[model samples]
Target: MGSIFGTDGIRGIYGDDKVNEDMAFRLGKAFVQFLKRSSDHPEVIVGRDTRISGERLQKEMARGIIVGGGRAFISPIITTPGLSYLVHANRADGGVMITASHNPPQYNGFKFFNSGGEKLSRSEETVLENLLSDTDPDRGLKIREEAVYLKEATESYVRFLLSTIPKDMDFRGIFIILDCANGATSSVASELFSRLNIVHGLINCAGDGENINRGCGALYPDSLKEYVLHLKAVAGFSFDGDGDRVVAVDERGDVIDGDQILIIASRLLKERGILKNNLVVSTIMSNMGLMDALRDMGLRHIECDVGDRNVYETMKAHGAVLGGEESGHIIFREHHVTGDGLLTSLQILFAMKYFNLPLSKMSKWMVPFPRVMLNVGVKKRPEINSVAAIRKVIEDAKKDLLNKGRVLVRYSGTEPVCRVMVEGKDRKRIDAWANKIADVIRLNLN
Candidate 1:
């Protein structure tokens, strides 16, 4: 058997070699067995996105859970963080979320959370994978024919979301736009907004399975930006397919990404004297502007690798309450165990109201340096240090930038490409340097 978990979880194209029903079944069984090692009668809360393959995967996993002598409760069509919340809220042994998270419709996967609503650590995943190797698929384990569905799971999650905001707060004059990415949030975003009496407009809330993330959501916020401008709303938010990520557009139609969001939120939290240790955690992908802004506010930040799990671990170690990725996975440790798009959106709104400032004005506190990024397709991902030519190019670029900027070159964890990022005071100079690095990578690796 090979490793099943990725930086997030097990993900692949549906019906593909790694993500078929059989694999899902085996994983389900393995997960339950691993849980049973500690608890005799384990229970799991299962949820999924709006992908067409989600239902089938959920069924197979649930079947395995039941066969392994564990109870499986299905929470249909919920966000990833919603599932995480349910696991901790209900004290289930674990939780499984079926989603590919901003991927195309053809792709689907699983993200597992512990009873604490936190993602499984690397060692935990290793233990589960080891169990998968010992399980016998043909052992004639009796599979349950029916699944127990949780009807009030969505409502419970919504109440939790509302509880995070103060009751006296209102959104009567605040008009905002939302692009649901035609995925899991579509089923709940409107209800949550209505319950809060928020004046909001929505787009891309209709999901046809295949239409989810098709030029919408966080990956493509241009349409959402246009809609925000048209409505002249105070702000706009676009959530990814699984509702784990978000990208925003300000009143001035300028995009505010996760880094900016982190800065803004950090400032607010610091004002309230709740920013733990006065530290914020961000990934390597975060912009230098965020660091500058944090410094200007007399706050500090630490850099982790490019995953929320990594960010969470670092945040925990350092007693930081806030952390996020540039791609919009913002984790507020005080309120959520995982990155939540809905929660992040609400927090941004609360910040806007508390500061009594438009997003455009708040966003101006951080002026991002000019940066150029190029994704070079590669036949294989080689260790950067081992490739002498690539190393030389990277070092040369760093030397040229000196103290004025930075250069980051890393292989994409999920794709066959090398990302070369150059940030500097001059856009043209950085673009040239970035292309120079990309050319070296393509020439040597591709």
Candidate 2:
């Protein structure tokens, strides 16, 4: 129960190795109490993915929510982005998404979103953490038998998904293929795709509870790629387990990543005179090609740390309308408070249709710079945060690159490793420099 929240939220392998029911209940209670002082008194919506433990964990979390004097309207097997949309759209006090997101099937988690339908900020997390630390662990256990809404949550989400899209996109002749990773969005993505009059190929559309995110969804999209090529479809989009991020495979069977998606979307939006400030915000993990492409289009580019939340922060601060991480966590500021993979994919494909260009042609807005990343586990996890030796390696690499290229060193938020990254036009040079930094970190920092 101690400090389970990471830079994102609480995530772990299911059962004893990870978060337990006791912890779930406590988090629920803690979240409820933390939000009680807000304008509304804890009318938090709750939702989970299609993992095997979703139902049981849902029950436990709901109980905790009720105990905290919060009414829990629990949704069964809903996508993460839908939960965010629900939180804000319904005017709920906040939302709790019980998803492990692209983690393995055996993992589960609890994510807290504020009234704005975005993930809680660092200050909010700190409040929750402080409350957890000061409270009695056994105090909130008695309220575990309270009430919750256990049905029909997915219906509202599906209806809203169809309603929120721009009225002009009609892909009547285009074919679409979607791989939902057999997770939460299985039912909704297909229905939405079909209603739009697009010829559709849907795979991994069945979540067996045991197969979520198992090399089929956005993370490993080879199967979708193969299916798209075989069907000769225009393009295919894949969603991760929780369905908040999307990746695509073009008609030529090449996998298109989040950077490419954002590039295409920005260009299209700019042309339509809808892109605010003519700017896009991306994380440091975004390819230099993406930055260059945005720059060439006379669009300003802002970069944040390597997370969707950071991108959102930059967008909010800079008045940008679009932002995302390279992992497909796109924040369409006009549409959502956070990343919505399915929606982002929809936006991209609709733009493609508007332009009537092949995915290959539409996607080639940028020439990707060669880059290499190496992660090294450390004996003392805090060394990545504190060690001077780690700093020297990055600074030296950056100086060496000196306008010709770039290097980035960061600690993994979900693991005890320091990541070393180098980027340049030359792949060999980038890899060599990345290895050099990795060697120094391995020998001296850790």
Best by TM-score: 1
**Whole-model lDDT, model 2:** 0.82
lDDT tens string, model 1, 68-113?
8888999979999999999999999999998999889999988888
- The superposed Cα distance between candidate 1 and the true structure at residue 328, in angstroms, equals 1.0
Instruction: Compose the digit string of candidate 2's lDDT tens values, residues 1-446.
Output: 44667767878778853477777777777888898887545888888898888877777777777877788887767888899988887888888888889988898888889888988887788898787665444633566345666465666777776775777767788887899998988968877777788788889989988999988998899999899989999899999999989998999999888899999889878888989988899988898889889889999998888777778888999999998877889888887888888788788887787888888998888788887978887765554536687677678778877886898887777667888879988777778889988887888755
Query: For model 2, how many clashes?
Result: 0
Score each candidate by Cα lDDT: 0.90, 0.82
RMSD of each: 1.4, 2.3
Off by over 4 Å in 1: 139-141
After superposing all C-alphas onto the true structure, candidate 1 shows an RMSD in angstroms of 1.4
Candidate 2 at residue 35, lDDT?
A: 86
Kindly give the number of clashing pairs for every candidate.
Answer: 0, 0
